[model samples]
Target: MTAQPNSTEARDMAYHLHSYTNPRKLEREGPLIIDRGEGIHVFDNSGKRYIEGMAGLWSVAVGFGEKRLVEAARRQMDKLPYYHTFSQKAHGPVVDLAEKLIGMAPVPMSKVYFANSGSEANDSAIKLVWYRSNALGRPEKKKIISRIKGYHGVTALSASLTGLPNNHRSFDLPLANILHTTCPHYRTGAEPGQDELAFSRCCAEELEALILEEGPETIAAFIGEPVMGAGGVIVPPEGYWAAIQDVLRKYDILLIADEVICGFGRTGNMFGSETFGMRPDIMTLSKQLSSSYQPIAALMINDSVYEPIANEADRIGALGHGFTASGHPVAAAVSLENLAIIEEKDLVGNVRRLAPHFLGRLNALERHPLAVEARGIGLIGALELEAADGAAAGATGARVGAILQRNGLICRNIGDSIAFCPPMIITAAEIDEMFDIVEASLGELGQQAAA
Candidate 1:
C-alpha cells in the first residue's frame, strides 16, 4: 500500500517528477526521503541509515555533509553570491578553479569552459566540435562517434552521443551526425575464443570501418568514458584506448573523454584518462568536481581545439555561447574547497590504499550463485548477475538489487549488473559492511529463485 496522504511521501508524490524513474510506480510506492547524511551514509526521514554504495550516482567523492564544502559555499555566498561569465566577465573563484584544473589535467589542456552539469558540458562539447570544424573550413566534418553502452549525458546532443537505448527510445534522439560503434566489453561482446587484445583490435577496426563508410570528411570526433559508467559500469578491454586512439589519429578525429563519472580519483588515479591511457583533445568533467555539493561541470579543450574557435569568435564578433550560471561563484568556491580537501587529505591515496580491499571483496562476490562476473578497478566495481535459465534478462538482478536496498545498501542495478561505488572517504570496515549486505541480499535472492 502507498504511504498515507499528507505525509512527506505523499507530498513528494503530489508534485515531484523524478528523472529515470517510473512515475506510476513512484506515485504508488513513494520516495525514500533522505533527511540527512554523514560520511558515506544517509538516513531516511524515518531515521533509517543506509550505506551509499553507488556514491549517489557515482559522484560524491568526498561523501556527504562535508562541513568544509558547506563553509566554502557560505563564504562565497557572503562575499559574492552570483555572477556571470558572459561578455568576458569573470570571477576570481571561477578563474582559480579553471587554472587549477588545467594545471592538474593528465595532459596539457589550454582552456576551461564551465557548465552546470555533465550533460551541459558534453552538450557544449558537441557545439564546440561543430563550431571548430566549421571554423577550420571543414563544415562537413561534424559526425561524432560514441560507443554502444557508453553514457555521456541526458541533454539533447549529449543524449544522442549516449549509446544506451532507453535514453533514445521515444525521444527521436540520436539526432543527425551521431554514430555508435562497438563497446569494448570483451567478456560480454567478444566471441568465445577471441582474446582481449584481438577484441580491442576488432573494436578499433569497426570504428575505422564506420569512419570510412561515412567518409572521414564527415567524421568530426569520437567520445568515450575512461570506464563506462551508467552502462553497467563497463571497464573497457585491454588496449582498447590505444587502439581507438590510433583510429582517431588516422582520421584526424577529435577525442572527447567523458570524465563525468571517472574524474576526481574514482579510479584510483586523479583522472580515469591517466588510468586508461587516453590522450583526449577535449575532456568533459563533472559529478565529483564539487563532490556534488554544488552543481558544476567543465569542458577542457587543448590549444589545438581552442585556437580555431577563438579565431572564429573574433571573426564573428563574439564567442556566441555561454550559460547564465556558467561559472557561478558559489559553485566555484565549493569546487575549489572540494579539490583542496582531496589534495590535503590525499583522498586519491586513500582510494589507492583501499582499492585492494574493495576489489578483493568485489571479486569474491563471483562465488555467489547469482554472480556471473565481478569486475572493476579502484573503489568502483560491478557484480553482474547471471539471470536464471528461462528468466527474463535483468529480472533476477533487479530483484536482487531491490533486496539489497531493503537491507540498507543503496546501489544501482544497470540491467543485471549491480554497481558499487562507495565514497572515497569510506574505510575498509565500511567496505566490508557494504559487501556483507550485498552477499546477504544475494543469498536471499538465491533462496527465492530456488523456491
Candidate 2:
C-alpha cells in the first residue's frame, strides 16, 4: 500500500478548488481521491472498489481503462500530436471525425463544429443561433428558451441557457434574453387526475403562452435534453417533444437538443434526438463522443441553420470564433475509435436488451419506505427519497448518498433524488449487484428514519 499520506485529506482541502461544490463543505470533508478504474468499476486510494454508477459524471460510455482507446490516442499522438482547425487549417483525424459525426447525425446535418467540452459546444450553439438570426435579418429574435429543470452547460451563454436555479443564482445569469418555461415532470408537476398526455398538453400550452407573452419575434431558439440528466433524470411525459416541436415550428424558432448526457447509446440510441423524436435545428454532442477518454465535443447544425451562418461568415471575413484545442487530432482519433468500439461490441444493442430489466428492478424500489418515486429509461434511473415526517425530501438525499458511498456504491444525489447512470457496458449480473447495494442502503436509511 503506497505509504498513505500523513495528512492527505488536509492537503486536498488546501489545494483543490472543486466545481459545483460547496467550498466550505469541501474544506471540511476533503476529496475522495480515486486512483484508477477497470471495466465499470473504479478503485480509490485505499484500494476500495466501487461500481462507477454515474459513469464518471455521465460520460465514460465505454467504461474506464479501455486499452483500444488508449492505443488510438497514443498512435495519433505519435503520428500528429496536435493540430488546430482554425483559419481554414485542418487535419485528417479531425476531418474524418467530423465526417463520421455528420454522417451519423439523426437528422440531416450540414456541418459539424468542434469544441473542447459540452459547455463550449453549447456556448457555440448559442452564438450560431444569434448569428444565423442576424444573417436572416431577424436580430430581434435573439432570446433563447429552455425548460426550468433542463441543464445545458456552465459557460456564460450556455449557463444562461441552462434553466436550473443553482446555475443562475448570484452569477447574474440568464443574461438578458434567456427565458425558462416549466419542467414536464408528471409525477412532480402534474395536478390531481392529470395524466401524462394532459401534462404534455399543459407543457405545450405553457410554452406557447410564454412565447406569446415575450412576443414570438423575440425568441430565436428553444433548447432541451431529451431525457433530463442532472435535473433528476426526468424523462419527458408522452407526446411532450412532439407537442413542443409543433410550438417551435409555428413560431419559426429553432430547436437545440442538448444531448450532452444522453448521446452515444445512453438511451439505447445513437442520439437522444432519435429516441425522443426531436428534429433539432442544432444539436450539441459530448460526454460519450470520446467516452470520456479525451476532452472533446461537437455542435452539429442542419442545412437551414448552417447555410445562413456560413453565408454570414463569408461576408464577415471570418467566423472569428474557435477554441485553441477545437478538434484536437488526438481527441478526434480516440473519439473515432471509441465510436467504432461501441458499434463493434453492439453496446447499443446491449442497452436496448437490458433496459427493460434495469427498469423493472428500479421500479420495484418505488414502494420502499425511502422511495417516493422510481423513474428511469435505459440505464439511467433515480430513486427519489421522501421527507421523513413531512420534513423535506432531497434534503437528506445527499446524506443518503454519502451513506451509499460508505456502503460500496457510487452514485449522485440531485436534490433528494439518488441518480444511477451505470456505464452501458455493465452486465445484467452487475445490474443486480448495483441494485442490491442500493436496496441495502435504502433499508438502512428506512430503519434510521423509523428509529
Candidate 3:
C-alpha cells in the first residue's frame, strides 16, 4: 500500500536522502519508519514489533532501550555536555574512555584516538598509516591494501579502502595508491579441486604477489575485517589468518584490523582479533562500542605505529588532524557506561553460552529450499539463498528480507545472503523466536515463489 500523504513515511520520502538507498525507489516504496525500541525489539510507526535481527545495522550490542546508557548520557549532558580534544584539552569522559579502551585492547595498544563512527575511525587509520609512513621518512610506503568485498566506510578515503565495486562506481573513488587483494571466503574463491588449506595459501600468495608487485617497501598497511560483515558476512576458512599474517610479517607490513562489526562479543570473543589471532599494529573499532546509543568509535595504535607519529607531531608543532566532535563528552560517557554494562553483565559470556543455539538454528537453514549456504559465529549469521533462474542476483534474497521483516524479524541482505546479528542481551527464548520467524517467513517466501 502507498504511504498516506503527510505521514512520517511520506515526509521522509520528500525530505530524506537515505544512505545506501535509491532516491527514486523511495518515491515508490517509502521507508519503514521505526518509532521506538526496547531490549531486542523495535516497533515501526504502525506499532508492529520486530526482532531487530540485524541489531540496527549490526551495532547495538547491549540492545535497544538500555537505560544505563541513557542515564550515562543524561548525567554527562548535565555535567559536561560538550568539549573538544584539540590541542591538549581533555575531559574526564574522553580521558576515561581512552584509558579503558587501551586497557581492553586485544593487543598491546599504546594509545587510543576517538572518532564519531566506524567510517571516520577507518579513514583516520588510513590517514595515520600514511602519516606514520611519512613520519618515518618513508613517504613511498603509502599504499594500503584492503581485501575485495571489504566494507570500510563511505568517506572518500575509507570508501577507497572498501573493496565493494558499488562504493567506487560513481564516486570515481578507490583513489590512487589503494589496492585490493582476494577476499578470504574459501568456499567462493577456492579452485575446483582445492582444499581449505590450499585456498588459504592461494589467498596469502595473492597478498604476497600484490605486495611484491607494488614493492614491499611501498606498501604501508593491509587492512581487513576478521569476518567481512557488509560483504555478506564472509568468515575466513581454517588456517587463513595464520597464513595471511605470515605474509604480512615477512613483508614487514603493518596490519590494520577493521573490527567495526566483530568487536564487543559479536564474534563469540571480546574481539575478533582474539578469535582470529590477528596481531594488528592498528585497530579500528565502532558499532557496538557505545552500543549505538551514542555515535562513537576508536582507533588504537601500538608503540611501533605511534612513536613515529608522535615524533612527527612534535616536530610539526601540531598533528593537524582531528574532528570537532572527536571525543564528545556525552558520547564518551555513554560509551564508558556501555562498556561497563557489557562487562558487568558478562555479555561476552552470554554470547558464548547462546552461540551454539544461534549458529545451530542458522546452520539448519541449509535444509530449507531457498538456502544454499549458512555461515555464522556467535549471534551473527547469514543465509545465502538460491535465486530463481533468470532473476537478478539479489532479487530472491531481497524478497525474502521483505517477507521476513513483515513477519516481525528484520534482517539485512547482501547479495544472496540475509544476515542476522541480534543484540547480545537477547535471551535463549528470544533466539528461538527470532529463528522461528525466519523459518516461517522463508517458508512463506518459498510458497509464494512456488505459486
All predictions: root-mean-square deviation over Cα? Answer: 1.9, 2.5, 2.0
Q: Over 4 Å off in model 2, which ranges?
A: 1-8, 390-393
Better of 2 and 3 by lDDT: 3
Task: Highest lDDT: give the candidate number.
Answer: 1
Q: Write the per-residue lDDT of candidate 1 for residues 1-451, one digit (tens) a residue.
A: 9765698888899988999999998977789899999999999999999999988989998999999999999999999999999877899999999999999999999999999999999999999999999999999999999989989989989999999999999999989989999988888789999999999999999999999999999999999999998988889899999999999999899999999999999999999999999999999999999999899999999999999999999999998898899989999999999999999999999999999999999999998877789989998999999888898888877788789989999999988899999899999999999999998898898788779
Candidate lDDT (C-alpha), each: 0.93, 0.91, 0.92
Off by over 4 Å in 1: 1-5
Among all windows of ten consecutive residues in candidate 3, which has the lowest summed lDDT? 2-11
Tell me how far the alpha carbon of residue 361 in candidate 2 is from the true structure, in angstroms, after superposition: 1.1
Collision count for each candidate, in order? 0, 1, 0
Model 1 residue 69 distance off true place after TM-score fit, in angstroms: 0.4
Pairs in clash, predicted candidate 1: none
Residue 73 miss distance in model 1 (angstroms): 0.5
